[model samples]
Target: MPNSTTDTYLIGDMKNGKPFNGFFIYPRTNIWLIFDFYLNGKRLFQVYNDLLTASMVEDTETSFTAISNKNIFVNDRLKSGIEVTPVRVKKGIVDIARNVNNFRTTGFILTLFDNRSPEYIEIRPIAHGYELISTDKNTIEVTYHASGKKLVFRDLEGRVLTKSKRFNSDHYSITLEKLAYTLKYRLVDAESLERFVKEQW
Candidate 1:
């Protein structure tokens, strides 16, 4: 399999007999399918929360064959299809995370696709020594503070998932039906903050 570098694949026709064409990330246990498109010369990616059940159809040294049983949502309706023989199979997020060299010391944002809804979650990192804000809106903000070196996962309406005084990466592995995430971070020199933003944002 290839690395996390963006690759192209074919999304077959829908089960309802509708023709479809798109690109997606390689199938993995947990991954995002970002459809790329151009509008007025501006590139954009449409992220979808999709589940795949893949079975090998053929195998070759250069490329392999597989069919994916895809479950996705379109137009507020659940759609399913069996994609036969995708063009290529590349690596995904989970694969990149397994390779430690990809780790960034500075904080970063993780964009997640919610399986149950069209809404997605944006996990943002707050700088140290800042006052956390509170809002009663539907959008939630999960904050990590340096005071007690604790990480607080909560919704804007005030629902807590895991709050630990001690920083632990495993705390985020727990599945919360409304909001689920896997947090990973590394401590870096405070001076590198600017560079981090440029690289991530």
Candidate 2:
């Protein structure tokens, strides 16, 4: 019920060496992307809006089609995409999440760059319809950019956390076709990144 996990966000090098990551940013209503999850036992529905709404199901390999009615957005802003990690609790139930929540979302986005060397950032739009171009290979160009900050983290015998180099509020953007990277990147849903980071702890 969503666009994709961080798994399929690669292009041009699926069968070769370690594939390159293309951080394709989904089209934003304002400045955010929303992902909705619905879990029915082993099957979980991940839905997102990319101009028009799109979705996918995860946790099973059964070849089938998933169809369900969902309200993608409540207002005109992006909703928080938090994944419930407790096995006893359903990950996608909003009401249950409210009652059983414990994780603090203060530095959530900072945790997304855990081990993935996130490289390029691509902002694309739908022209006529969805082009379904790999991830960052845009059929119709909307806007493509990325900005890397000096990041720091300790991966020792203990725990490792995503740390930002900047402590203050600062936003920067870099636009390019291909940029030289000491580290590459990944294109993913904001919520998937959130869930992935949350599970690690």
Candidate 3:
């Protein structure tokens, strides 16, 4: 098995010659897993909140499915103009293309790959509803809306990084230095409150 790591990639419309820097996490093979994508150093998808995952299927042509968790927070705020595309990377001697299509509510497909099975695949989400508020060497802030409520996320110190709105949701996230923290609304509203900690990037 290949050890999981974030691999840097240069991806975009090859014809344009303006490929942006991106990265994806490939922790394992044969199973769809979360892929983190970025463009010009800005994370394009909230893979941690969206729970994005994908896997390649064996067939005459390359095929795969990328899915996001079906949760109210995501469903309520999903951008109507979502766009997806397969990214081809140059790995040594072979040039592999991970063709993707059939985009739907919570997932998409990697239709094929240049007539060969790809050892790995990378997918990119063109637009997500959230907007970047600010960033510094130590912290980053982002904002989005859900259930008619505004959400503001900041790095450590629990500061109101953005002036967009007041903290409305019981759910929120924060990252400071090396520590990641989140308050899941679903878990908080559940019958039993369970303490769960998850790593985010």
Candidate 4:
């Protein structure tokens, strides 16, 4: 692939001689904005969020800061964005394009500079409707929203662990045993979710 220079998130600058900008999408937040800038194959300037600015000398650094600006868009809605200062950064190098089974297991944990506790966290296998389960013998609690809402805090074997109150929202979560493997069970938003699953399966 030659790479794309023409996108909605990029801004052309003939004056500054910057040809293209790279954009990244935050899957959980549904936020899409400029992720990096390439000026003739050299990454001169890069921004993680809308607030902070960074420079790439040799392209080793993976983390960047997010700044509040009018250019940033979240969920296809415009807003006065806030700054995202990374509290922790992880570095990984792999060819995801070639190996279609690559799924990002861990993600960046970010805490705002002004806030003490972490505000934003990223996780994998996100979709409109999904269920997290422990692949081991441990029981996983869940509230399945089929035709009627049912709350069963139990494992797949129907061992009742706890009871949950009635909820009406499609967005929900249940914890999986940390030591055991987990599986997401659901097929919501088939067009986007199915394609991702097929590639990563």
Best by lDDT: 4
TM-scores of the candidates are: 0.23, 0.18, 0.19, 0.25
Q: Between 3 and 4, whose TM-score is larger?
A: 4
What lDDT does the true structure give each of the candidates?
A: 0.29, 0.25, 0.29, 0.30
Pairing residues by index, what is the TM-score of model 1?
Answer: 0.23
Best by TM-score: 4
Scored by lDDT, model 1 comes in at 0.29
Error of 1 at 193 (Å): 20
Candidate 4: residue pairs that collide:
49-65, 49-66, 49-67, 50-67, 51-66, 51-67, 51-68
In candidate 2, which residue ranges exceed 4 Å CA deviation?
1-25, 29-73, 82-105, 110-116, 119-154, 159-201
lDDT (Cα, 0-100) at 130 in candidate 4: 25
Give a tens-digit lDDT track for model 3, residues 33-103.
33444466544542321211233223222233334432112333434322333233232112112222233
User: For model 1, how does the per-residue alpha-carbon lDDT over 1-201 read when each residue is reduced to its tens digit?
Assistant: 132322343443233443233443434323434343222232233333222211122234322223222333344332332111111122212211110112332222222223332222223345542112222122334334454344455544456655422243222222222231223233322223323323332
- Residues forming the 10-long window of minimal summed lDDT in candidate 1: 92-101
> Number of clashing residue pairs in every model?
0, 12, 1, 7
